[model samples]
Target chain A: MNHSVRAVDRIAPRRQGNWDWRAAGNFVAGGAGGGVLACVAALSIGLGFDPRLLLAVGLAMMGFGLTCVWFEIGRPWRAMNVFRHVGSSWMTREAYVALFAMGTGLLAIGLGTRPLVAATGLLGLLFIYAQARILAANKGIPAWRHGRCLPVVLSTGLAEGAGLVACAGAWAAWWRYPAMLLVPLCAWRVIAWRRYLAALAADGAPVGTLTAFRRINSLFVWGGNLVPVVLAGVAVLADAPILAVLAGMLTVAAGWQMKYSLVCRAAFTQGFALPKQPVRGNSRTGPGVKPGWQWNRWLTD
Target chain B: MKRYAMVIDLRRCVGCQTCTAACKSANATPTGVQWRRVLDLESGEFPDVRRSFVPVACMHCANPPCEEVCPTTATKKRADGLVTIDYDICIGCANCIMACPYDARSIIHQPQYAYGDQPIASEAARMDSQHIGVATKCTFCKDRIDLAERTGQIPGRDPEVTPACVNSCISGAMHFGDILDSDSNVSRLLAENESFRMHEELGTAPAVHYILDRR
Candidate 1:
C-alpha cells in the first residue's frame, strides 16, 4: 500500500484528565446498586399486608433515591429548577412520573382502591422503564448504550421489587401469586444477567471508569444470578416463604452489583476520524504542498 | 415569531468563564445554581494537548423531552421559541433534573444573596428564608429584556431586549438573535460555519449551535 508516512503518524494519543473516574464510579455504583436495593425494598414492602401501604412505603423509598441523584449534581438544591427546561428535559419527565406514581400509590392505599393500586403499579412500571431509558439515552456513556438490556434490567428490577413485596404479602394472606410471579422475575433477572455479560464480552470493555467490570460481572453471575435462581427454586419446591425472602435478598444484592458494574465500566470516546494524507509523488498535492518536498515529510520519510 | 438562539464561536473563546460569571450575576443565581457551565474537555497527550471548552446551557429544543413528561405543564415553550418555566406551577419534583443531558437545571432550596449581603446581615437572614424552596435558573435575563423593551430603552433602536450574557460577552464569541431572521447574527454564523447542536441524535433539536474549537 502506498500510504504516506504522514498518514501513519497522524494518529495522536488521546488524553483524558483523570477520566472523571471517581464521579463516574460513584454514579454507576449508586445508580445501579442503589436502584437494585430500592427495587428489593419496594417489592418486600408491596408484598406485606395492605399492598397499598407497602406501595406507598416503596414509593417513598424511591423519593429517597431521588436524593441520591441530587447528591450527584454539583448543586442539589437547584435540582428543582430542572423543570425550567421541562420542554426539553428527560429528568423532568422522570420526576413527574415518579411523583405521579407516588401520589397514585398513596391514594390507592388511603382510599383502599384495588383498581387504583393496579393502575399506579402499571405507571410505576413505566416510571422505572423511563429511568432505564433515561440512562440509555446518554450517548456519551458507552455502557448505557445497550438498548436491549435496558428494558430487561428494568423489568427484572420491577419483578424484584414485586417479589420482595410478595414475600411480605404472603405473610398477610396465603396467596401464592406473588411467589409465582417471582418465578418469571427470577427468569428475567437471569436473562438480563446473560445479556449484560454478553454485551461486556462482545464490547471487550465494560462501559465507564471501573476497569474491573468483567470481574464484578462474574461475581454477579455467581452471587446474583446463580444463587437467587437456585434459592428461589428451592423455596418454591419447599413451599417456604422464608426461603423465598432469603433468595430475594440475594437477588437484590447481586442486581445492585450488576448495576454498579454497568455504570462504572462505561467508556466514552470521540467518534471523528482523523484527516488523511495524500501519497507522495502523486499530483494531488497541487496547492498546499511544495513540489519535491511533501508536507509532513518529517513523519513520512 | 422570533426564535431566540445562540451561536458560540468556540475557536475564539478563551474559556475565561466570563460568560458563566455574567450569567450568574445577571440571573441572581443562588450558591449552587449555575445556568451556564464550561466543560474543559482535554484531548491528546501532554506534548500534543488540545482542550475544548463546551459552555452549555438550556438548549431550548423544538421538541423538548421535559415538557412531554411534566405532569403540571409548568414548563412550556413560547411561540417565540424560548422555553420558560412557570415557577408557580413547579412542584419541586426533579423529573426535569434527571432528564437533562447537559445537566443544565437546578432546584433552589436556599436564599440567594448578592455581593453586599453578608451572613450576619439582618436583611440577608430575612431574604434567605423568603426565597428558600424555589426552583430557579437563567430566564435569559427575561426581566431585564422585558423592562428594556417595555420602556423603549433598548440599544441602537433595536426593539428587542438583548440577554445580559450576550451583552457582557467580551470575546463576541456568544451571538444571540432571532434564528428565524435570515440576516440575524446567529443565522449568518450558522450559514458560515460547520456548526452542530449538542446531542443532536436524541432528537431534542436544541436551538444552541456550537462551532467546536477543534485544534
Candidate 2:
C-alpha cells in the first residue's frame, strides 16, 4: 500500500512530539489488563471458575499504567483536574469509567459475587472503548483520527485479554475453558488489522506513519497472529499447557507492539498544506499542495 | 460579533521570517519553541517548482479542536475570537497538542533559556513559570488587543494595539482586524483578494486566512 512518495518527510507532517514511551505504556498495559479482567469475568459468569488471582493482576496492571501517565504529566498534583471536562473530553470519561471499574472490581473480589464480576467486565469493555476514543479524538494525527481505528483498538484489547486467559491456564486447573477461545480472538484481531490498514491507505496517511505500520505488517500477520493461532491449536491437540502459555505470551506481545507503533511511531500531524499554489507572475492560482497526503479524500480542491 | 481575524497577503510576502522573530521577542518563549512560525513549502517537479513561505500561528478557530479535547478546560476561546490557555489549571497532558491540526500549541516541560544553560538578562526578567509545564500558544497578542479596548482605540488600526507579527511584517503582507466588520482592514482585504483558510477542509473554520492575490 505504498505510494510513490518522492518528497522528504520534512515536507510532510512531522511525527507528534508530545506523547512518547510513557504514553504508549498506558495503552499497552491498560488495554491488556482491561482485556484480562473482561475475559476472566466472562469465564467466571459462565464456567464458575474462581479467577481471583488473575483478576487482581488485571487491576494492578491498570493502576501501573495510570502511574506511567502520571509521571508523563508535568503537574502531578493537578492531575485531579483531568475530570474537569466530563461534558466533552474523552479523557474525563476514561477517568470516570476507570473509577467505576476499580470500585466494581474491588467489590467483586471482596464479595465473591457473580453479578459484581459481570459488572466489572462491562466496565472493562467500556474502559477499552474509552481508551480507543481517547486516541481517535486526536484530529491532528492521521492514524489516530481514522474511523477504522476504533475496531482495531477494541479487537486488539480483547485479543490480548483472551491471550492472557490462555496464559493463566498454565497455573489454573480449568485452563481449557478460556484457552479454547484464544485462537478465534487472535484471528479476529488479524482481520481487524487488515481492515484498518486498508482503510488508512485508501484515506492516505503520513508516509513515515504508513511505512512504520508496513514494517510491522508481516510480523503482525505472520509471526504474531498465525504463529499464536497455530501454537494454541497445537496445545489443544497435544493437551500441552506450555504451548498454550507460549501462544498467549506471543499474542500479548504482538498487541503491545502494535499499540506502541500506533501511539509513538505513527503519530504524525497533518502538516501544513496550500490549497492554491501561487504562480510567480500569474494572478490565477495553480494546483494545491498537500505534501504527505497524496490521496487525501478530505482535501478540498 | 467582533470575530478578529488575520489576513496574510501571499503575493507581498518575501519570506524574511521577521514575524517569527517578532513573536518570540514579544512573547519571550523559551529556546526551541516558537508560537508563530513560517513554513517553507516547495511543491511540484524540477522545472515547475512553486515555493511559498507561509506564516502560521494558532488559527484561533471558531470551532477549536484543542478546546474539544482538553480534559482540564485549559485551552479556551475568548469572546474576541482569540484562543487562549489557562496555565493554572492545565495538568500538562498534551492532549490539546495532539488535537491541534495547525501544530500551534506547545508545552515547555523545563525552563529553557535563549543562551546556553542560562537565561540572559531580558530572558530572566520576563521568564514565566506558569508556561513552563502547561500548554501555550499564540494569543493573537491578546494583551495588546485588550489594552487597546481599554484605551478606546481600534486594535488592528493602531500599531500599538496590533499583534507583534502583524506590526513587524516587513512587506505589509499581514493585516489584522475584525473580519465580521465589513469596513475593517482584514474584512476589506479579504473582500478584495482571493483568500482561503488553511485546512478549512478539517471544519476548524480558521480565523487566519491566506490571501493569494491582490485585487
Candidate 3:
C-alpha cells in the first residue's frame, strides 16, 4: 500500500483553433459547387438552356474553396505535397479528385461534351465525400467525427447546389424542372440535419457544443429548413420564379451557416479522460472520468 | 522486433512538472508550447475524493491517426513503431493536429524568443528553423535513443539514451523501454500492474500506458 495524497478535478472540452473560416469556406463553397455539378449531370436533360454558364460558376466556386484551403495552410508553398499521400489521406484524394473535377468541367465547358459533364459531376460528388471524410477522420474533434456528419454534410452540399441552380439562368421558363430537385434536396437536408442533431445528443458530445447547436436550432430548422422548403413549394405552385430564387438563396445561405457552426463554433477537442480513478490506498481504484463529455456509455463505464 | 513505449505510474506521480521543464530545456520549445504535460485529473465527491497527476506526451501509437491523415506523407511510423514527422516534408496543414486524440501535435506559425524580439544566445543557437511552420511533438527523445542504439548501448538502461522527461521525473514514475521485449522494464511494469492506455476505445493502440496498481 504505497500512495500519496493529491487533489484532482476535470478538464473541459477545448475548442480547436487550427481550422477557422478558411476551413469552413472549403466545405461551404466546395459542397455547393459539387452539388451544382451533380445537378447538371443528373438533371440537365430537356431543359432547353445551355449549361456553359452553370459549368463556369461551379468551377469558379470550387476554385474559391481551394484557394481558401491554400491560404489557411501554414506552408502554402508546399501545398503540392498534398498529392504525395493519396494512398491513405482523404485530403490528398480530395486534391486529386478536385483536379480531375476541374479538368473535366473545363473540358465539358470547352467541348460541350455530354460524357464529360457526367464525369465532372461524379468527380464533384466524390470531392464532397472526400471532404466529409477529411472532417470525420479527425478523431480529436467530436462534432466532425460523428458518423452522422457524412449524411449531414453531403445532403447540405447537394441541397445548396440544387438551390443555386434552380433559381438561376433562364429560370422563368424552366423553374419547374430544377424545382423538382430543389424541393426534394432541401427536404432531405432537413432530415439529415435532424438525424445529425439527434445522434449528437444520443451519442454524447461536449456540453458546450451541445449548447452551441441548441442555440441555433430555431434558426436552422425554421429559417434554413422549413421556411425555404415552404417557399419552394409556393414558388412552384404559384408559377413564380422570383419566389423560387428567394428560396434557393435561403437554402444556400443556411447550408453555409450550418457548416460554419460545425467547423468553427462547435468543433471542440475530445479533452483528456481517465477510465479509472486511483485512490491513495492499497492498489485500489476509484472511478473513471471524462471531462465535459457526460453520456450513457462514459457514465456507465 | 521493437516497440517503444512509456509506462507512467499514476500513484507515484506528484505533478511536480520537473519533466515538463526538462523536456522544454532539452527540446527548446517556444514559451507557450509544451511537448510534455501533466494533467491534474480529479474525480469522486468531496468527502471521498481522489486526485491524480497524469504525465502525458506523444504516445507514438501503433495505429497512429496522425500518420494515417498526413496529406504530405510527412508523418510516418517506423518499423519499430516510433511514429515520426519529417519537418522538411510537412506542409503544416495541421491535419495531424486534428487527427491526434492525445492533442500531442502543434504547429507554431512563428518563432518566439524567451526575451522580447531579441534572442538570448541560447535561444538563438537552439532554435530549429525547420521545426517552424510544421507539426511537431515529442519523439520519445528519438535522437538520444537512435544515437545510443547506433553505438550499441541499450536505451532503457542508459540514462543518456532515455527521454529527457523520463530522466527528469522526480518521483521515478516514468519508465521508457521496448514493450516488444518480454523482460524490458516497460513490459514488466505493464504485466505487474493494472494498466490502461488513453483512448483505447479509439483503437489508436497508444504506446503510453498508465499503471493504476503495483505488483
Candidate 4:
C-alpha cells in the first residue's frame, strides 16, 4: 500500500454558507441607513435641518438593505419566520427592533418632538448593536466570532451615519458639528481596525483572512479614516464646507469596504479539528493538524 | 427516556467504505450530499507514515448549536436525544448550516439522479430531500428506530432496525445503542475503552464516541 502523506492544508476541507456579500450589504445599509436617520433627527432637534428629507433617505436605504437579504434566503416565502425565535436568536431580535425603529422614526419626523426623536435615535443604536450581535453569535467562523467584531461593526455604522449627516450639513451650512464628530470617530475606526488585525494575526487566523484584511485595511485607513479626518480638519482650517462634504462621502465608502471584506473575502468557515491522530503499526500517536491556516513563516509573519 | 448513541472502534475499521455505500443506498441522498462519510487521514514523515480512517457524521450534540441559531423552530432536539430538522417550516436561510461546527449539514439545492441526466427516481429524493432548497442531514435512520421502539425491540442489537451504516459495518467496528442504559452495548464499550469525541472542547457534548486502537 502506498503511504504518501499530503500536506495538511491541502487535505482538510473548509465549510460552506456562513454568509456572503449580500448579507454584508444588509448590515451596511441597515446600520448606516438607520444611523443617518438617527443623526439627522438629532440635528433637526438641534440645528433645525429638514427632518422629512433626511428621514426619507434613511428609510429608503434601510428598505433596500432588507430587500437584498430577502432574496438571499433559500425559502423567501417563509421569511417572516425570522421573527419567531426572539428568545435565543439575535436575527429575530433585529427584525423586531427594526420595526420599532421605523415606527418611532416616522413619529419623530411627523411630530418633531424631542422625546420622539430621542426614542427613535436610541432604537436606531440598538438596531446596529443587534446587527453586530448577529455576526458575533456565529461561533463557526473565527473572524466573525471574535470579540472585536462587535466594536468594528458598531463603529462602522456610526462613522457611516455621521458621514451622511456631514454631507447634508454642508448644504445646510451646519457642517461644523458632523465634521468635528467625523474626525474623532474616523480616528477611532483606524485605531480599532489596527488592533483587530493584530488580534487576528496573533490568534493564528488563516493567512488568507489576514491578507484580505490587510488589503482592505489600506483603503479604509487612507480613504475612510485618515482621508476623512484630513478633509474634515482642512474644512475647519480653511472654512470650506466642500472639504467637509468630501470627507463624509469618503467615510461612507470606507464603511462599505469594511463590511465587504469581512463578509465576503475574509469570511472563512471554521472547518473540522481532530483532537488525536490515528495510529498505525506501533508508531507513536501525534496531534491532528489544522489545515486552513498558511504555515510559511515569511508569508504568515 | 431512551437516549441513543454510537461508538466506533478504530482498530477493526479498514476504510472499506461499505458503511458509506450502505448509507447512500438506504437514504437515496442527492448527488454531492453525503449523510455518512469516511475521512482518510494520512500523517507522519516518509518511511514511517501513518494512515487512519475516521468515519464522521452528525454528532447530535446534547446542546446543539444548530437548534439554538435556527430562526424558525425547524431544527429540534427530540426527547430521545435525536436531532431532527423539520423541512416544512425551515426557511433555508442557511443559519443552521453555519452554526453546525461539525460540517454535518448540507443545503440541498436541486434534485439530481445518480446517473447524469437519467431522470431516474432516487428514493432519497423525497420528503426532506424533495424540498429543492432545505437543510438535510442524517436522522440516524429515525424511521427504523421508531418501528423498533414501537415493537418493544432493542435497537443496535437488532440488525433489522439499527442505523444502516452501523448494520453494514463488515468488521463490526460500529456499535449503536442507548448510552443511558447500563446494559446497552454502547455503554459497555464506552466503559471498556479509551474514547474521545470530535471537538469536545466546544462544549457540544456529542453523543458519538470513538475508541482509539490499542496497539
Ten-residue region with minimum lDDT total, candidate 3 chain A: A1-10
Give candidate 3 regions above 4 Å deviation: A1-10, A46-48, A170-172, A281-283, A296-301
Question: lDDT tens string, model 1, B21-89?
Answer: 888666656665678866554433445334445566777778765555554566677776667777656
Per-residue C-alpha lDDT of model 1 across residues A169-281, encoded as one tens digit per residue = 55655435455556677677677756664654554321222244445656666676567667667766787777677766666666655654454443332221212211123
Candidate 4, A47: how far from true, in Å?
A: 3.6
DockQ of 4: 0.50
| lDDT per residue as tens, model 2, A144-185 | 989899988998888888888888767677776656778888
Better of 3 and 4 by lDDT: 3
> Which numbered prediction scores highest in DockQ against the true structure?
2
Among all windows of ten consecutive residues in candidate 1 chain A, which has the lowest summed lDDT?
A285-294
Candidate 2 — which residues are off by over 4 angstroms?
A1-11, A294-301
Question: How well does candidate 2 score on lDDT at residue A26?
Answer: 81
The predicted structure with the larger lDDT, 1 or 3, is: 3
Model 1 Cα shift for residue A91 (angstroms) = 9.1
Model 3: how far residue B183 lies from native, Å: 0.6
DockQ scores for all predicted structures: 0.07, 0.58, 0.57, 0.50
lDDT of 4 by residue, A75-123 (tens): 8898988888888888888888888878887887788677777777777
Q: In terms of lDDT, which candidate is strongest?
A: 2
